[model samples]
Target: MSAPRFALGATVRIAERTPPVHHRVPSYAKGQVGRIVRVCHEHGLPEAYIRGDGRPFQRLYRVRLDQKALWRDYAGAAGDTLDIEIFEPWLEPAE
Candidate 1:
């Protein structure tokens, strides 16, 4: 199989399914639009989820989105943005 295609500055949609209970992924960000920034090397969830290390740093794609896309009509700077670490499974080709 070919390496999954993804690109920097590419638009992706976060799926609607809720994350595992107690996961670090935030609830508000579900089903949001974000631009893929980086495709980090992959690692197993079990190894990445080792306890006692504070936040679990799961292998994920770094995404950057405009604050307005995440929150409409908010009183934040127009240039404000949000950077979120989202697993590959959580994202799909937007539209």
Candidate 2:
């Protein structure tokens, strides 16, 4: 197996580009910054899977982001957060 691209607690930013075909990344997560909460299991890329390809398995991560950061007018408490499972390819290291 290959080494994990991100460790727990590492900060990451979701990629903002759109896929040419089907994808699993949620639209609301694009360009958002979050911290890796868990190193989830690896799986085949959804885009590739839909095309019937099975040679790829990308690391998945559970990232946590403040709800307020995702929405400008979030009405929830300051501590409200959203956790999302993201594939490694959709994430980039945040400075």
Candidate 3:
């Protein structure tokens, strides 16, 4: 096992690239900024899984994003949030 690329409470940005095939990152999360709320267990990358690579494992994180930030016309309360589980490779340190 290797050290996790991201620490708890760290802010990160979801990569916006569109894959040619199956992917786990949702369309709403692309390019969105969020904070790491929890560090879940490591798992294989879905990208690799779709490609039949069974040995690749990456850290999974539960990120919390404000609902208002994801939707321009969101009518929910200011405190509403969305939690998403994302793989390490799909995330980068928020600038």
Candidate 4:
């Protein structure tokens, strides 16, 4: 069976602790507002070398966050936005 596909634009709840961590994705981003941007069809090597949970990866989502939301005392153009891709396991239906 194919891995299930999560809904885009669907709110998800992040695990208190889960999946592993990588440089691309930050730990502070956990339990934050992120929107699904795209879905990766192919499976590649696991990004988390520390966890060694490299199986097959699916459910890629593009999460957007405000610059001020991620940082404090921000001195950048107002309304700046940042985007990141996260796996399904990293998120669930947000309460």
Pick by lDDT: which candidate is best? 2
True-structure RMSD, every candidate: 4.6, 1.0, 1.1, 3.7
- Candidate 1 displacement at residue 5 in angstroms: 3.5
Candidate 4: TM-score?
0.62
Residues 13-83, model 4: lDDT tens digits? 54455444443456677767655555555343356545566566445666666677667787898789777
lDDT of 2 by residue, 1-95 (tens): 56889999999999998988888888999999999999988888888887687447888999999999999999999999999999999999997
Better structure of 2 and 3 per lDDT: 2
Q: What lDDT would candidate 2 get against the real structure?
A: 0.91
Clashes of each: 0, 0, 0, 4
Give the alpha carbon lDDT tens digit for every residue of 1-95 in model 3: 67888999999999999999888998999999999999988888887887677457888999999999999999999999999999989999995
Q: Model 2: what TM-score?
A: 0.94
What candidate 4 gets wrong by more than 4 Å, as runs, is 1-4, 13-24, 42-53
Local distance difference test, candidate 1: 0.71
Pairs that collide, model 4: 12-92, 12-94, 13-92, 37-62
Model 1: residues with Cα > 4 Å off, grouped in runs:
1-4, 19-22, 46-59
Model 1, 1-95: lDDT tens digits are 22545678889987787544455567778888888888776543432454545333344678887897788777898889888887776788884
